[model samples]
Target: MASKVIHAIYTDDDILLQAVKQVRAGRYHIAEIYTPFPVHGLDKAMGLEPTRLAITSFLYGLVGLAVAIVMMNYMMIEDWPQDIGGKPSFSFLSNLPAFVPIIFELTVFFAAHLMVITFYMRSKLWPFKEAENPDVRTTDDHFLMEIDVEDHDVNQLSKFLYDTGALEINLIDNK
Candidate 1:
């Protein structure tokens, strides 16, 4: 089976944003967007829900904190008790102050690394994955908006996008 879509190209982000809003106003469906850089409010304009990556990051940080605390307790207090200066303390609770730096570092490390991995996976950006962008110009200065062609007249949709200031329009067929 083959599916057809319309690709509208815009030279400016502002124009693309406006075109998106107008398309949605007309109750048209936008399949995807490709841009060289992030456009502020584009997601909201596209009617996308807020991301939950921040919540996941906080949970990952908590896991890192727990791992750091347990590792420190086992290594410092139980595994190899060290005696420095005049005091020899072998209790994790009593030596928690000294482990603050390690805990903080581990928490940050886990959160940042795991967040990147989660984003990549969620976006289906696997190693050696083929690119999905229909046009290479979108990676440079152009912005491309993909509009679904379901239950809509192609000529009318292309005409609408042209009126909305699309620099170029293309019909793509996917198998």
Candidate 2:
């Protein structure tokens, strides 16, 4: 089976935003948009659901904090109790101030690194991944919008895109 899609290219981000709004207002479904840089408020403009990555990051941070606490307690208090600088090592609670920096660093490190990995995995991006943009120009200065052509009149869609200030319009058939 072959599916048809229209690719509309725009040179400016503002123009692309307006086009997206107009397309949505016209009840047309936009499959995706590609831009060289992040466009502010694009997710809201496209009606995309809110992301849950922040919650995941918080959970990762908590895990890191817990690991740091356990490791510090075992190494500094239980495993080998040592008074480094007149600070008592027998009680973990009394020496918690000294471990604050380590705990903070580990929490930030785990959250950042794990969040990046999660994003990559969620987006299916990895080493040797092929480019998915339909037009190479979209990787540079152009923005590309993909609209599904299911049961819609191609000519009308093209004209509407043109009226929305698309630089170039292309119809693609994917089988």
TM values, all candidates: 0.96, 0.95
Index of the highest-lDDT prediction: 2
Off by over 4 Å in 1: none
Cα-based lDDT for every prediction: 0.93, 0.94
Candidate 1 has its poorest 10 consecutive residues by lDDT at: 84-93
Each candidate: how many clashes? 0, 0
Question: Cα deviation in Å at residue 98, candidate 2?
Answer: 0.6
Extract clashing residue pairs from model 1: none
Show pairs that collide, candidate 2.
none
Q: Give one digit per residue, the lDDT tens place, for model 1 in 1-175.
A: 2298899999999999999999999998899999999999899999999999999999999999999999998898888888866445667888888889999999999999999999999999999999987899999999999988988999999999999999999998888
User: Candidate 2 lDDT, tens digit per residue, 18-97?
Assistant: 99999999999999999999999889999999999999999999999999999999999999999798999889899999
The global Cα lDDT (0 to 1) of model 1 is: 0.93
For candidate 2, the TM-score is: 0.95
After TM-score superposition, the amount by which residue 7's alpha carbon in candidate 2 deviates from its true location, in angstroms, is 0.4
